[model samples]
Target: MNLNELLTDAVAGAINTLYGMRPSLDIIQLQKTRKDFEGNITLVTFPLLRISKKSPEETGANIGGYLKENTGIVSGFNCVKGFLNLIVSDAYYINFINNSFGNNFYGFKPPDTGAEKIMVEYSSPNTNKPLHLGHIRNNLLGNSLCRILEANGKHVIKTNIVNDRGIHICKSMLAWQKWGNGQTPESSGKKGDHLVGDFYVKFDLEYKKQISELVAGGMQEEAAGREAPIMKEAQEMLRKWESRDSQVLELWEMMNQWVYSGFDVTYKRLGVGFDKIYYESDTYIIGRDTVLEGLKKGVFYQRPDSSVWVDLTKDGLDEKILLRSDGTSVYMTQDIGTAQIRQTDFSPDKMVYVVGNEQNYHFKVLALILDKLGYSWAKGLYHMSYGMVELPEGKMKSREGTVVDADDLMDDMIDTAKAMADELGKLEGLTGLEKEDTYRIIGLGALKYFILKVDPVKNMVFDPRESIDFNGNTGPFIQYTYARIRSVLRKASDAGIMFGEKIPERINIGNKEKSILAILYDFPSVVAEAGNNFSPALIANYIYDLVKEYNQFYHDFSIIKESDGNLRNFRLMLSDMVGTVIKNGMGLLGIEVPERM
Candidate 1:
């Protein structure tokens, strides 16, 4: 048990012996004592005033005295108003360190057999464009959540639903066919996704030009947009592709394959992947079948134009379209089908969709529709909605070709890391290859950490320069601290110092040493909290706080140079534990920390 649980049980015993009443666990309010106070755990005695039949101070003193006298755990106590601050004996912390130190998986729990499985769906990228800043945040949050959840001992399945077949996809294909004289990724010498993305932009530009001309010729803007020749052609292409026209299907398959190849490269570079990938083309038909079945069962209604929809007015939502009038399935249909497919495959206990906040209403309607369709697992579906990520310049527009491509952003971060490291002379002893690899680690670490350090629900601006800084709460700062700890341990080992065994029991540990131990004790709880809240920012910030504290402790104390063997060994072991926790925490964030920098 942790310190708090031990103290709680002691308090419960004290309460029963003194007051002749058994209190619920909720009545035992134990918290970390404030820094200004002289204790490790503080109990609020105000809640027990009625049972004590005394004032707050008297109640606190009674409990404090009882704990100190009855239990060996409490070394001393102080009554500050209604607060009972109990100081734990040095032996308690020493015992904690002895038991916990040298444990590489100190904070992680192995998954139990027959655990509830959670499926997390993220990076639902449309095949028409390469990933950008927004997708980066999505992937990082989703990927980190998986790690955090697994750390909490849940079986997590990472998944992606590729938006491969849609009108937007047709826009790129048609543009490629009409404008390009048989150009391909190889012929254009560009990444396949980038090439396909260029055509998407081209289609938008031509469509806008057509709209402007039609409006100038006395047509309404909406009418012009719907009637534009390119828009008509793209819609027709979608219909042909749906009908399995050999030529259109062949083109669709070829372009989607190219996009898939490009997406794999990006996902690998971003350190995110999926156990299963569902395509819109494959799931839409299942959705159509399901919706048609729902219609026959009166779960849905058909409009005069023959479109299928579900009325969610009773659930405080408006009607949601399941299929267009021409029998093409909408996004909602594919999502329903995808959820069913996943349920059949994994039988997950929970289904999580890691999409942005803009689709909030869409998911809400989806859950309601699925419940109406008699899927009991619909209630378990969760939307891990996050806000958008923008650069310092402003919001990005994909169709305008103004978004920062994920591949380009990663390259820029690495280059910036190299420049910063070079300017600071951090790469002096490293060979060219080592320097490059270190730069990549620092660069990618910075990118992932900066984006994830924020609460996922809040929109924020990303600055590359600020993220790579070596002195703040940035990833490199924590990474550098870890490297420093490793260096110290190496020197200690070379000097024939042994840290494999626990320190001598009689050794005295100061408050700084105890403080590090306290934080280390909180790692498992922090991981649990991160999992419970589904927020990686908690883990990110926890590591930052730990690193910050360790840096102060390092500056204030001597480890390898200490004259006392026990003291030096204790400090070295403590430092090693801190480094291990740091590496483990960063690993949960899908970031790598260099051993030497």
Candidate 2:
């Protein structure tokens, strides 16, 4: 047992012995002692005060005296304001490390011991635009969440739903059809998604110009926007797409292929993939039919204009439309269809939608409507809402100068990594190919770490320069620390020093060494907590703190150079475990730790 469980049982007996009561869990609250206190575990005596019928100090002294005498691990005790602090013996920490020496992935739970199937949907990108900085955050958060759940032993399925058919997509297609001699990705020498995205911006500019002319001719702004020639053509294209017109279908298929081709390159570069992908064009039919079925069953109501909607006023939400008057399905319709199909396919215990915070109400309506339609699994749907990620001002921006493309941001990060690595001579003693791969790892690591380190619910500004720094709470810093540990292990291996099958005997450990053990012991709990709360920031920051502690331990002690053979070997074992934990912990965040820098 760990320190908490060991002390909890001992403290519970003390409460019964002193007060003649079987102590409840709440009454025997045990936690890590405060940093200011000279102990490893602290027991709150205030809870026991009610049963002891004494003052806080008197109650603490009563329990502290009992624990010091009876608990072998409790070497000494100090009491302050009824908080009983127990200084655990050094042998406890040494035993903990030795027990953990052989398990490479010490913190992760076994698969058979955790939750069942879970489906996580993220990177739900539209075909009209390339993934931008915001989608990068979504992809990273979702990817990390999947890994975190797996570490907790949950069977996770990573999925994405592509929004391939909409007025926005039609806008790009219409612009391309009107503007030029047919240009493709091969001809333009640009990424297919970028090429398609360029036309999306072009469509907006022309549509705006037409609206301005109509407004100058005395039309109201809203009316002019509605009547804009380009707008009308895009709407017609959408109508044709829904009906699957041969010409429109041909163009749609060609354009979306270009976008998908581009998305593949970006997804590969960003190191994210989906187990399955859904498309709106296919699922919209399912959603439209489902909504119509709901209307017929009276679960939803039909408006006079023939549109369908669900009434959620009783649930404290407004009415939500499932289909437009012209028979075009709304986003909600496609979502309903997507959920139905996913449920039929996976039968997952939970469905997590990792999208931006802007769509909070949309998901709420989705679950409520699905429940109203008698789909029992609707309650398991969760929205992993996150805020937007913006580049520092004057940095890279999209073609419209508002969004930042994933491809461009990654390029900048890798370039920044190369420049910094070269300047510091960190890339010395490596070949041309090794240097290239290391730079990619460091750059992507910096990017993923900087973004994942922030809480998912908060807006963040990503500065490429700030992220690539070799020191501080950054990816490269942790990566470098891990490399440092690996270097120590390699030298020991070269010197023919290795631990055997038997657990090492308890040796003298100093304050720094003890601190490292204490931090290392919390790894499993940290992974569990991160998985339970769906917060990767927890794992990210936890690894950073552990790295910081080990770095301090390294600077203050001797390992291979220690004069005593036992102490030196123990330190080597400690270093090896630290390295293993670092690698395993970072894996939960979907990060790779290079063996060398």
Candidate 3:
């Protein structure tokens, strides 16, 4: 029932008859007519000129004549230069729009059969700190991607691989230990993760001071800094904790719980939760064993220092270390183990790693290693690489302590939303808690929309000042549109304005209404494309475009007019359907469509 499909078939048939040869065309895009153009849906005749051996005008005339002769669907046709412009009947547009009402939300249709199962791993946060804007992007993308895939009838497993154990975590432990007061989140009145994060920051400061003193004391001429007292002490603690030193192990477990607890709150707020969680503590040894097996099978090389590596020179890269000299598993090694574990657990048809673009080479190396290890499933592994989230000022550097904390960013957004709501006198009818919830929904909607608006491969700036505007291409605009629709629906319900019709197939299309209908008709194709491309931005862009078109239609036409029962009822149904699509699309992007924002 796709209008483009019907149009393409008709155009291709006409072209074939006109030229005595079949023409190739799939999507005959219906574009808006410009001032010079007599009709929309222009068919460029330049490609046909060589075959037709005629001038551009002659070719266009032949094609336009053939289309008019062969098809009843096209209302009229005009030839201008090399362009054959076809005008589709208003009746056809009306039929297409009316028939779309009963389709699934967002015009989505489930896959016919044999859909592949996919596992998407994203929002892999470290337990040493709380979530930040970077994690927000990951969460939204991952969560929305899952929705998109599901809409396309693919089975999707949304997972998170928590980097819970590392030398960095040991530093926080060291700080808490030497500082001596065993403080819980409750006792310290600090958020669990932030409390742990405070210790992490404390560790860095003290460790720096300790390193400076060591250098002043002329410890090994400052070349062996990692071997200094502070760093070495942190490393020693890591070893002890790994060996399950009773007190150290207990503290590590406790602090990790604190961080995870804090993360749960943030995840709930963001409206994204993982289906499964993988821990480095559990997978590192599995990676070690996998590497050892690879070494035995001659897939990897071991150095005299007892480190294992893969010579990726064949794959246009240097030898990547799979294991450290101390017999510890490296990042790549743990990844291998995680992949194997996931394959065993789910046996998914596709495994998507939603990591940042800086690790593009790393993922390439991983695919090579997996293939070398003789896993056929390795070929199906995909790297969903996204660019780093930069602030309006510049890139965030974690080492420089300039990275934005995820929880803090969320708080700031919420505060901004509340202020805006207060200024508009919008929260006056709501209770304090209801007001808080409203702000949270609007704030998070803005954050998710901003992140998902940009294509994944392109770097985006987080402009705190204007990213959440209600008047333009922003989350608030979409939310307000949905709210307006909801309000209309409520009013209809209260006024007993039934949408019932003897013939539910009637569509009365104005110019603006037809434009909105065209966009609405494209939702299925948009969702499918987004899923295929692994870009939630596609859905985000589609929804924004949909709502924009709807707004234009809303301004140009009245849906609530007391007179003209058929037209008003049809328009109300159209608005309601559009509202459903918007809500569904926003939901896929991990955004809330507030009913009364």
TM-scores for the candidates: 0.97, 0.96, 0.94
lDDT of 1: 0.90
User: CA lDDT of each candidate?
Assistant: 0.90, 0.87, 0.81
CA displacement after TM-score superposition, residue 77 of candidate 2 (Å): 1.9
Best by lDDT: 1
- Tens-digit per-residue lDDT, 374-429, candidate 3: 99999999999998888877988766877888787888888889999999997687
Q: List, in order, the clash count of every candidate structure.
A: 0, 0, 2
Evaluated at residue 194, the lDDT of candidate 3 is: 87
In terms of lDDT, the poorest run of 10 residues in model 3 is 500-509
Task: Estimate the lDDT of model 3.
Answer: 0.81
For 425-495, candidate 2 gives per-residue lDDT tens digits of 98799999999888888888988999999999998877756765657998888999999998988888898
Candidate 2 TM-score over all chains jointly: 0.96
> Which residue pairs does candidate 1 place in steric collision?
none
lDDT rank order: 1, 2, 3
